[model samples]
Target chain A: AQSVAQPEDQVNVAEGNPLTVKCTYSVSGNPYLFWYVQYPNRGLQFLLKYITGDNLVKGSYGFEAEFNKSQTSFHLKKPSALVSDSALYFCAVRDGKDIFGKGTRLHILP
Target chain B: GAGVSQTPSNKVTEKGKYVELRCDPISGHTALYWYRQSLGQGPEFLIYFQGTGAADDSGLPNDRFFAVRPEGSVSTLKIQRTERGDSAVYLCASSPGVGPLYGYTFGSGTRLTVV
Candidate 1:
């Protein structure tokens, strides 16, 4: 079955430090990868997506993701973290339907 | 509306009761989707509608779960004999189409608590 995997349940990073939330996927055809963030009690907000072009896709709020076809991974990254960036992150892949991975909670410490 | 909208931001219902959660997609969006998100988990696909027809509903767990988008705009997800396991946040999203060009815009969601 087509699926996306977020290996980390929680990731902690000191404010201003670089942060990375890992994700991997298993699908048959060319993958359409996307990243979404959810704040407490709020709906998910789109961050970035990777369809076919460049591997590095930048998105809202200084967020970007690197799509590695060889590794079947689309990891979300940020150059510098902020306390407001702490939220739940989800990695999704579009097969027939949009399949989401177990979310990873990111904590940006002060 | 400016974005997708879901009604009853929170619902606390007794188990075995039936409930309906509503979703109003963004104006002009042709594709609407429903998902369920449990505590500490990501949203799981439940159903998808395209222009008043159910394009895909294979993700719905059982027959008790049904949805309709009669006008291809507003949708209602109906769940019968609700159980404790059904307690989760029901999310509604919409996109221009099912193509890769557009990402989904999700609503705040309706938290259904079955007790």
Candidate 2:
């Protein structure tokens, strides 16, 4: 069974400060990881994905993720957080069916 | 369509009634997926359609839920004897290909509420 785990339920970060949302996965074969963001009353938007090659993958809206194979982690990161960046973040892994984690609520304090 | 489109932005139905949700995937996308999302939870996969056939449907909760993609471009999710527990946002997404290589383009989703 392919499963993703987001340890933090919520993360609060000060505006302009760096932020990180942790994610880990358990899968049988090669892990294909992805990051998605959902705003209020909106659908999940694709941020970035790690299929192969580069361990550090960059995504939309100044977002990036580091895929650690040994640790089984794909953590979302941003150098400077903005107030508008506050939303629900999801970490997903694809095998046959794409499975998402519970999600972490990111709150950027202004 | 430029992106995935789902009909009925919001729907309210009485318990035991039948309701259907529609999804129009991207024009060239061959893979379509349906998911149900409850409050504060991740999207739960209901089914996946590759072309016109359902490749996987193990995520469907019960027999009351059914889906079809007759033309391979548009898909419909039909629910019978709806219950209050069925209240959640139904999301539709489409990808150009299957598996991990491509990212999906999601629709706004249909908010279904069973009263």
Docking class for candidate 1 = high
Write down the worst ten-residue block by lDDT for model 2 chain B: B97-106
Q: How accurate locally is residue B19 in candidate 2, as Cα lDDT from 0 to 100?
A: 99
Candidate 2 at B47: error in angstroms?
0.2
Task: Give stretches of model 1 more than 4 Å off.
Answer: none
Model 2: colliding residue pairs: none
Per-prediction DockQ: 0.81, 0.80
**Cα deviation of B79 in candidate 1 (Å)?**
0.7
Candidate with maximal DockQ: 1
lDDT of 2: 0.95
Q: Which residue pairs of candidate 1 clash? A: none
**Clash totals, every prediction:** 0, 0
Can you write out model 2's per-residue Cα lDDT over A1-110, one digit (the tens) per residue? 99999999999999999999999999998999999999987878999999999999999999999999899999999999999999999999996768999999999999
